[model samples]
Target: MFPIRDHNPSERTPYVTIGLIFANLVMFLLTMPWGLNAEGLWVYGALYAGAVTQGDMMWGLLTHMFLHAGLMHFAGNMLFLWIFGDNLEDQLGHLPFLGFYLICGLAAAAGQISAEPGSTIPMVGASGAIAGVMGGYLLLFPRARVDVLAIIVIIVKVFTLPAWVMLGVWFALQLMGGYTTPGDSGGVAYWAHSGGFVAGALLTLPVLLRKGGSRFWSRTDGHPPHDPIDYGHRSRVPQIPRR
Candidate 1:
């Protein structure tokens, strides 16, 4: 299951979120050939992407977020960012949101490294950073509705759920993944996701408190300050009577 959109609308344009999406896309284009070639991916990953290597910790912490193992990796991260990031940018503003994002990304990298300190595998992608965005969204708008598309077997279903339920389930899955999958084991970075989420929630706590803590929730009733936008309306296909 993946989020398709949110009911909450941003008060202002989410420039930072858009910029971030653009940057990730640009980076992917720049590194497209490397992603397409296995050997190239290794070389690019080793030199630039962050890895928990025995050698001195390099610039990968900063660079790794821009790299992705494949197109799906990049697309998935971008999708989450698009779906959840605007509200964060609305709450945190542009520059602060950018800072929060970087900090969460750093925390995410640290979380991964901590999980496997000696692994030479390069951890790439924006999953960790976007996970942070999800965390912030959970804390800020637990009652807001999110639209999710789930595919079970051959059936496709679209459901609307509260932000807490959506994000809570996502976090739980990450925790499970972290336990079952070894860190830096050439798959998902469950630790990074969990870590970034924690960091995002903690970092957003002060902001939430500043907004009057419980009062904020009470005032907004845990929903967005504005009315939810209904994006689920389906156009009916016209039927012609048999002639």
Candidate 2:
């Protein structure tokens, strides 16, 4: 299941979110040629991306967040950023949100590296940063309803679930995967995802407290400041004539 949207509304335009999406897309296109050649992939990934064993390029911590392994990887990370980053940017303001993103991403890299410091495989993607946004969203809008598309075999359904349930499941999966999968494995950076999320949630705590914390929760009822939107639908099936 993947989130389609959320009922929460932001007070202002999320310039940072849009800018991040644009940057990620541009980087993805620019890096597409690297995927076609094995040597190119290694050369690019090492020079720009972060690896547990590579300590020469200190900038890799930040650059790696912009690099992606493939098209689907780019799309998935950007989609999460689009869905959750806006509200966070609204809450933290443009500059603060940018700082928060980079910090979480840096933390994510550290987390992954800590999991296997001797591994040489390069880790790339914005998922760790995006996971931070999800963590913040959960803290700010636990009760907010998120529209999700669920597919089971041949059946397709849309369900509106509370943000806590949706994000909790995602976080849980990351934790489970982080523990079960060896960090030396060259694949998903589960530890980064889990670590970034925790950092995001905790980092936003002070902001939430200043907003009144429990009182804020009471006022918004753990949702957005506005009334929830109606996502109901009328059946599309043609009606049969009644006897």
lDDT of 1 by residue, 1-243 (tens): 988888999989999999999988877876777543444533454322234454454667767777776788989899999989999999999999999999999899888877777666767888888889999999989999998899999999999999999999999999999899855576788888999999999999999999999999999999997898988567698877998
Could you give candidate 2's per-residue lDDT for residues 1-243 as a string of tens digits?
A: 898888877788999999999987777766677533434433454422334356576667777888887878888889889989998999899999999999999878878877877666777899998999999989998999999999999999988999999999999999999999965777888988998999999999998999999999999889977777676777999999999
Worst 10 residues of 2 by lDDT: 41-50
How large is the C-alpha RMSD of every model relative to the true structure? 4.4, 4.0
TM-score of each: 0.89, 0.88
Candidate 1 Cα outliers beyond 4 Å, as residue runs: 34-57, 232-243
Go through the candidates in order and give the clash count of each: 0, 0
TM-score of 1: 0.89
Show the colliding residue pairs in model 2: none
Error of 1 at 221 (Å): 1.4
lDDT of 2 at 66: 86
